[model samples]
Target chain A: MSYPRLLRRTLLYIGATAFALWVLIPIFLIAISSFTPPNEIYAWPKPIIPSRFSLDTMRFFLNSYGVLNSLRNSILVALLTLAFTLAVGAPAGYAVARFSFRGREAFRLGILITRMFPTALLAVPLAVTFIKWGLYDTLIGVALIHTAMALPFAVIITTGIFMGVPKDLEEAAMTLGCSRFGAFVRVALPLALPGLAAAAMFTFVISWNEVFAATILTVNNRTLPAHILTTIQASPLYFRFAGGFFMTIPALFFMFFIRRYLFHMWGGATAER
Target chain B: MAAEIRLEKVRKTFGKVVAVKDMDLLVEPGEFLVLLGPSGCGKTTTLRCIAGLERVDHGRVYIGGRDVTELPPSKRGIAMVFQSYAVFPHMTVAQNIGFGLRMRRAPKNEIKKAVQEVARLLQIDELLDRYPSQLSGGQRQRVAVARALVMRPEVLLMDEPLSNLDALLRLQMRAELKKLHREVGTTTVYVTHDQIEALSLGDRIAVMREGEIMQLDAPNEVYDMPANVFVGGFIGTPPMNFLRAEVRKEDGGVYLAVGDFSVEVHKEWQEKLEGMVGKKVVLGIRAENIEVRPTPEGGALPARVVVSEPLGAQQLLTVQVGKDVLKVATSTELSATPGQTIGLVLTKAKIRLFDEESGEALKFD
Candidate 1:
């Protein structure tokens, strides 16, 4: 094309490549180091590319004490968090999207305001309350905290999802022999499925990766991240890399499976037709 | 099964803005009643109220003699065609049309038969397997109509259903809707701001203004005998011209005195004008009712043509009479050009007088 257009295109490519490398390079290093043998992991001026690869580090990390139990706990907690967030947040989102009520704006702001408090600030008080309620050191206790952490995002995402579904479709269903609740269940829910999937993925990933609340909430029923955090500093270099790489796997697979839905959500519900 | 709908003392408001003020209306069974008004005049709100979509603040809604004010829309035995033609984008045409039947838990074979029958009626049978996104605007509209019609509801509510279509398609669909109504004979309440649609489709038109029905009558009567200034002005294209005049008893005859000229009141209206003497009134006349001639004829008021537009079959002439500009629809054969002095005669029986202050029509036997 013209000179300025060619210069602009080259600059855009450079910026995009730089951003991609910024995110991918760290993940790449951890992944390669996790596969590297323990002897080569901490070589002087560490190798940019691993010359030898083995599964010994991964095997050792997987077989370590409490690693398998903590993996199970992590999956259970993430699933529970997904269920709790969707159950609570979807309806709240639908309400915020559909209804015009007193203090609606304030209510929405209040939901977001919960996120402003750092986990560090809430952990000690939450631990005391959990002990009184008999939820201390339990997987349910950790999952509940994760739900609290992820719920704000869930509500905000689902509000946009439900808003994207036209109010007329629900009204049409109501007039077509469906009650208001029935209309919501049959029409609005189905139309909002893809976006809801995207929201669920976010909840799953957030619970999967969260460490701070998991560490504070439970001891014996430690999730993957909490287990990794406690052992990684004392563990060998290869074990630390393996632990980091293992924690990233479930979240990566979750993103991969629902990548299409994420695109659908970002493209928006109105883009359907 | 056709059903009657009645609203009594219905009043609805949003926050502080009143959408439908205190109102009462009755629709005879199987009749097409059109609620015609400008936007925000509450025509759509009234339709929603009848459909149980909006609960009335202070009224009872009766559908087929059952007080359905507290009922949800599903229990109201009504179907509504939204202006957006809200056929579910995710569902194929068959599924969309069968949705209501499925909701009612109808038998599968029965739902299929009903859907196919309605699809054939709407002539969208071939597109039944296709999704809404695959259909044209007109086709999607037909699918929406079929979906509503297949429900066989007691009352069908349509809210500006044809407003989204192009002009030519709107006219075509308008005719189809009329034919469909004839065949179905469902009691229909349609809302639209298009005066032509109301005139052509409604069995009786309710002309509304400021959340109140100004007139409710047969289309011809609404056009011919508007109840007030708003109805008169709102109902017609090149709307009714209004002139300020005074009721004067001169030369033993009752005359409506214009700025410098006067038209004699008919003998039948003389008694009515006698009491209205010395009172100011507004005279309403349609554009087609006035006759224009090149020469000053007997009993013809003097006028000058300011602008003449040749509209193929007829010429629309903007003529000046005193301080007022009048739009006249006359024969294209008349070669009346701009700045030409012309004589105008207002048909005696066609003249309508309204109270200046209240804008209410002055009726006479």
Candidate 2:
């Protein structure tokens, strides 16, 4: 390689590494703080590397009032929200992708319009409706709202995935002795599996980290994010740090679970024969 | 099991577009019937209608002796090979070929045996464990054919299966497909836009235009005696040439008159075309049928050569006769040049006359 080209390539690597560190450093500091002793975390001009590691701060956060129950509530709500979003959104996505019916554009526009409204805008009316339906302070009510919030994105993502799969595969399957539904199950569903997994992971993350609707819809069944927000000001910095770190653990696990599909979904690598 | 297929008064429309209009067709048991036409001529639509991928608006479909118009594809007992070769990308070759048997809930051992048998028959047994992504285009197409054939359907439909390959591979697959069809004999209905493919593979060709069949006959009959002007113009390399003329009665016999030149009608056609006297008709003749001579002969039209293209075994001579330019295939050894005068005679070959306005053959069959 020529001198200038080699120098330019080396410079590019340095820039990329610096940018990666810039984004990762804050998350690393929070993670370390979650395991530091309370006194160590409070030291003036705190050491860059922790003097020692301790799980006492994490235990304190877990034992706090309603924290463990809220942790259970968060997990349950995220799973339920993921289920609801897929059940309602996947069929809608398929319909939009495969058909050219009247009002299709209008229906897509309607879904887009729902996303334009901030969650706070619907909180008051939804709260009243939940109380009237006797669903107040329940995990199901919050899950319903979270599902509504995540559904638009899920529908759009799944629509793109289903469109990428060729319709010829389904028609071939049907002609090879499969019914229309059977063709979908045997061909289309398997081809779109990676995209569906990515959509489900995204929904789980949205519901897991959501605070506004969860706080408004329930009191005793507050999700972890809502619980952390409610107790942040009253608690010490170490408790706040541990609570935030605990809230992030599920998102990390969800990413790890769907890592195989993540590159394909985001990079648009068709990998078709 | 081979079975005759029938479509009666099949009409299909998409919104306001009439794709197949009032069509009726029949395929004799184990006969290879090809639907040939240009794109958007409803040939593929007709094949899909037979496959039950598209429901007819007002027609009944029959396979064997059973009316399968309302039956779903699964119960209708037919298999199809798609033009795109839609093999399941996630499955291995063995699994793809065995999918139909698995769907029917056959015993696991039976499915495996059937898959192995089909792979060996297609000479793809060594590739059974490989996914579709690992195969070449021709290999993928073979896998698709194996998948369709393993079902042992009563009928098999192919929609331009060889149109996707390169020219060399297409020729190879075309011969293999013909051999397979002869051995299996499953009453095939193939569709293609290439006339060569239709002529080489079809026992009978159905040429379609504007949602209707223009001619349904054997390959040579359609080539030599096209039913109408469209079929004449649509088939053959460099297509058949056409000239505007009128039938005239000069002394008791009939002759076709064109600008200052005429050819007496043959005795066999004189009676059939007697009613066409004084009527404007379009005469159709193939390029190879016209004979070019160096000197004027009896009843030969004099013309100027516009271009001479030598193509090894024969030469294509474009000659201008009066106001029309006609392509004549002649011997490559016959020396000719642009602006040179030549004598063109078409009396010895078959002639087709069509009603110029309606574009239909003039004589009743």
The whole-model lDDT of each prediction reads 0.91, 0.89
Which candidate number maximizes TM-score?
A: 1
Model 1 segments beyond 4 Å from truth? A1-16, A44-47, A253-273, B295-299, B304-306, B335-340
Task: Write one digit per residue (lDDT tens) for candidate 1, span B1-365.
Answer: 99999999999999898999898999999999999999999999999999989989999999999999999999999999999999999999999999999999999999999999999999999999999999999999999999999999999999999999999999999999999999999999999999999999999999987789989999999999989999999888889988888999977899998877888778999987899899999999999999988865776888889999989889999988888888888999888978888888899889999999999999886
What CAPRI-style quality would you assign to candidate 1? high
lDDT of 2 by residue, A13-65 (tens): 99999998997787788899999998899898989888888999999999999
Per-model TM-score versus the true fold: 0.94, 0.92
Tens digits of per-residue lDDT for model 1 on A200-268? Answer: 988999999999989988878899999999988888888888999998887787787766655544443
The window of 10 residues in a row where model 1 chain A has the poorest summed lDDT is A264-273
For candidate 1, the lDDT comes to: 0.91
Model 1 misses residue A201 by how many Å? Answer: 0.7
Top lDDT prediction, candidate number: 1
Model 2, residue B2: distance off in Å is 1.5
RMSD of 2: 3.5
Model 2, A104: alpha-carbon shift in Å?
A: 1.7
* Chain A superposition TM-score, candidate 2: 0.86
Residues B1-365 of candidate 2: C-alpha lDDT, one tens digit per residue = 89999999999999998999899999999999999999999999999999998999998999997999998888888999999999999899999999888888999999999989888888999999999999999999999999999999899999999999999999999999999999998999999999999999999999999899999999999898888889988999878888888988888888898778887667878877788778998888899888889866776788899999999999999988888888999999899999999998885447788888988877744
